[model samples]
Target: MTTKVLLASADERTLERLSQVLAEADAIELVQVVREAANVEDALTRHPDVDVLVVDELIDSGRGLGVARTVGAANPLLGIVMLVDQAGPEQFAAAMESGARSVLSRTSSLAEVVSRLESVAHWVGAARSAVSADARSGRAGRVVAVAGAKGGVGASAVALLMAQSLVSSRTVGLVDFDLQSGDLAAYLGVHTRRSVVDLVDIAGEMTGRILRETSYDVPGGIRLLSAPNDGERGEEMTARAARSVVNALRYQYEVSIIDVGSHLTEATAAVLEEADVAVLVVTPDLPALRAARRTLAMWERLVVRQRSAVRVLLNRQHRRNEVTESLAAKIVESRVDATVPDGGSPFESAMNTASVAAASGPAHTAAAKFAAAVVGPVDDGPVDAVEEAYAEVAGRGRRRARGNDAGQSAVELPVAFAVALMVLLLAGQGLVWGTGYLLARNAAHEGARTVGLQAWGPSTPGAARADALDELSGRWRSAATVDVSPSDVTVHVVAPTVVPGVRLTSSVSAPVQREH
Candidate 1:
């Protein structure tokens, strides 16, 4: 467990002092000492086992921090401690931004320097051990890359929920690989101090512990590696860094969902290269489909990923969308894997609340299906964890929408009637109400099913709801209201009782059948 140290300083006196101090410290081995910033790289190359790099503030004609950045990028596992004349806030921030893990004043006592070295050594030791353990396990997780044809296409939502859905059976990692202008942190309502940029430097030695340290452990069993809040720092995540980070994620988590954002860059292209399942999210519109085609072609020409390897997902699609899935697939020259119905208000509300699980209605259902498509299908034996989570939240919301009237009857019968007569009337009313609820629910499902079965022409939701209502009895039809969409149908029935204004309401939702 000895920590190998490399000492780099332009000042002879500083170098001698630090080398002698580190060499004398227990469990610290001074493997290399260099007097120039330029020579540090060679020293590290010669001593690959070196864990810590102690650099002076003015090395190689005042390029000390520059050298720190270079070596840090080259050897991510190498702990960096910068020695400066003044360890002020500015100096410390500069050192950290340059990839130095810690900052120390040259005037500090040897004891303080040793304490700092040991602290850094502990982190490096744990990180290296985690990496070693992961390598030994020989486990590689699946990578799913989600790219948007254009902005505002709900690609980020898809990526976020996709990760959410997989958490039932596996450890999922959601990476905001968009680098510049990435908003996963904002979407999740989390502000992470460390980001993907932190891992870009240490990606080669990334482990579960390191990933956890640099990522925000979300509430629902997801680890999110956010993009840099400062958009300018995104340039640090180069193609090589992206590849290394994605590979390390694969070794650490059971599944990783990468949101590559709308614009494709070298870093994002690197992610696409590592993806086992690559999807381009596009709305059912001519402009989006054209953009998707161009993006696929660019990916092909750049040799980042093959066009055929990418699957197209239609977002914000309507039953009578101008661009059909088949037409869009033909336009993009890729298979349209699935379509997500326009979620309308509930979906928007969930996004605003930063809770994907709170989303109800057709959008949530479609998101679960999309996750299943990417990560394999969900079993029918039991309630799926993702679906169950959504349903639970939706149920709570619905309950809140209704008053706390549990254990109370919807209608109160008069005490003036005979007991037997009242019981019989109440029983009859209950039967009628129950029958009406069932009929309305069945009609809603029928509406969705009929809309899905249409192939020859566009089937509007209005027509579908009307046709389904026609199948119900006149009494039930008069009291039922229906709403239909490509993803599902919802129906609400108000069963009237003998007393005026005394009624019972029942709402039901069913999935809309469609051609897969």
Candidate 2:
């Protein structure tokens, strides 16, 4: 089919040039020619069959780029091209950000313009076809908002893994919506030249072609729309832009995973509004649980989505007795849908290699499998996906610690008993050891005084030593010794171990009494 084209240029000479180029091009027909950017949209409405829009940089009384951006956002499926002379890197970047599918130099030959138009037209057609197919099959895309119940719960990482798993059998769009500080590019090992910041200006025009230009490929067939490395740049994405971009992805891909970072914001909230499922990743700890509970309550109060739409994924779970699945669900006031084993070693390796931990190696297979199971093998389409996604783990709720006194004491009775037993054992040992030490020390002092008496000599020292041994007459008595001299006497005693393998020693000395 011949490609229908529209030309918008306030400059009469520029219009003549574009018209002449189009007339000479094969398989391209000039359908509408508007000399003003302000009149561009009306022309599109009149010529609804127009396939491509070629806008000159000088149109709209120097607001040509603004018009292009506006038009692109409203008609995302429409092909857009920016014609400029000597577009530097900055200008080219700006042009792309304004939603131009192709930016060509105004001085380019007719052949080059024809080739560019053909390429842009082809991509536009493909994008429209995909959306049409999605409509015909009643398969609106699934959107998963991976939101952290609290910071450092591995929500971003889980989001990435979910996308990776989903894309294994389907097309997935993984958007890094963590505007302030997202590292999706680093995680995917992608040195991205563009980011979501670039798409904000033309978010309304977020067609498949725009996604292709903004995203990078990662290891798991996931297309990543990286967040701005510069936090300040991230401020450019408004809530409307977020909604537009996410909505387009919802229509284009089978599944779209948005990394909403560990906390919430207007930008992230915009994405979450479209989520069929908000996988709230929380660590299995009391602090994280408390934070998650607060966050859930906030979500409910805000009425962002139904509480049922929120899926509680307790990540990095271990064998610790502190935070069980039942306990976490009770605390968070939500069902614990799934648990991901803390594959610490493999996780480190994956992050180092900038690959997905679940798909890194054999060691990470379990993590990968768990990710797949949670995200699901079933496709999310032809209906709302969250309900089905959650059905797998919803009803398996174990009874919470509920009863009089919250059943807390009953549940912890065993643990409390164990701890009490340990404390008693230690305190008992200390008492016995203290008693043994005091007795031994007293016995040694008594013996030293007895041997130091004027009438006592080396021969009589045995009697005193016996008296000292009799002071305890227990295991500690086995190693008592007394030394006598002309002027003084000394007694040494080895205190027996109160607790096994623990021994203490004591010694005492006294001046001998003499006639002088």
Candidate 3:
């Protein structure tokens, strides 16, 4: 990004010299000159892209401090330069209090002034990049925030995977804002000495160069801004610095993903508010669902009319007779955009190797849907159909929930059909057992008759009984026994049970008679 600068000074000589010096730098473009402090506001308004404000300490008849303070307060990311005749402790303090990064001697060589300007320009560009489009103009990076309703809910995994999905199409930045217990780095099997904490610590000297240095590349194409390696350093990062770093990331990447782990922090609110799609990743569990309800409620209460961007995502889903995605969403009073299948052995292998798994099926589909919620099509290819369907249902549900007949929508056809299918399967199993038992009984009776007839026929009773038992054995292979005597024949059979280690039995017999 080319840095835009507004040079303000009462003296034409100062303006001319500064303009000439800034013009010499390829990275900076002099937007306009502010002749007076009163004109500073108008100049910035006229050139909204101006990132740095260069003003003489004596500008506006010695009101430079007031102007710098006022402008700095409005645009915290803007870099301010104080031109001093002689630098001193008092002067430096005043300059900084007024939001200047550093003070440079007025009589400093053109080289020094140019160098200072370059530094300011870099920070200005970074600051400009940091803000979302909703916060500022010229940048349109889509921000997606993945936060857990509770710890260990896979928010970091969701965030990393979502970012990875977008990498094929756009530059992505994945930030670990979990702070205290950030395990995002561990998930990817990569570690970095520098982190977002480091960026925030040097906020005063923050520039594009500094911000880029703190980011580390992971196995996936996405760049990672991890939490501090030393857990104690989390508290050291302040909200203001985090804000700056976020804005810089917004400008630098096409999509920015933030993993704000379970607990709500001072900085988490800002990221959530700025995100285009703020996803609350939770499992279909009581604790996580409860936390999700609390978090979403709090967002509504705090942000006021800004909850539209919020989405609830269920992760690490497993097939259970009792758990359903719709139920979880209903309990949380939100829509479930997607249910990510459990990572399973693939994820476990990745964990062991410190790398990402090429997880297909549900995991891949969920990540693709997640990416589509906040970003455009991948590589100009179609967005995931599942995401499109999720989006459609969510829109309809919201509209239906708002209308007078909201309760009518509760009978969701899909959920109803799922329940119906389960019922059908259970009923079908009963029929299977009934038919098997009936057939077994008939076969046993037929066997008994054959032996009973033979006992009165030309063949010997033992041969007839053996033949009957063999026929019964083939027809009803489950289990069977036969007994024959001069006057009667009896047969017993056992059928397989629906469940393991259980069986169903049937019995039949016939009386012996003269050959008929």
Sorted on lDDT, highest at the top, how do the candidates line up?
1, 2, 3
Task: List model 2 lDDT by residue over 104-200, tens digit each.
Answer: 7878888888898998887676556544554544466678888887778887787777777666688888888888878878877888778888987
lDDT (Cα, tens digit) per residue for candidate 3, span 1-516: 576778888887777777777777777788888787878866775787776788788897888877786677455656788877788899888786555777777677667876787777665543333233223332346777788988888888778778877787788989999888887787777768888887764564453445566888776687888988887888777766666676667657778999978777677777776667788898978888888888888878877214456777888888962568988978888888788888788776775675663444568677778677657654343332223333444566556545544355556755755665555444434433433333343344344445545535556566545544543322255356666666655656664443578665655544543456
TM-score of 2: 0.50
Cα lDDT computed for each candidate against the true fold: 0.76, 0.71, 0.68
- Superposed Cα deviation of residue 338, candidate 1 (Å): 1.6
Question: Regarding TM-score, does 2 or 3 come out ahead?
Answer: 3
Instruction: Please estimate how well model 2 matches the true structure, expressed as its whole-model Cα lDDT.
Output: 0.71
Scored by Cα lDDT, where does model 3 land?
0.68
TM-score of each candidate structure, all chains considered together: 0.49, 0.50, 0.51
Report lDDT (Cα) of residue 392, candidate 2: 22
- Quote the lDDT for 278 in model 1: 93
As for lDDT, the candidate ahead, 1 or 3, is: 1
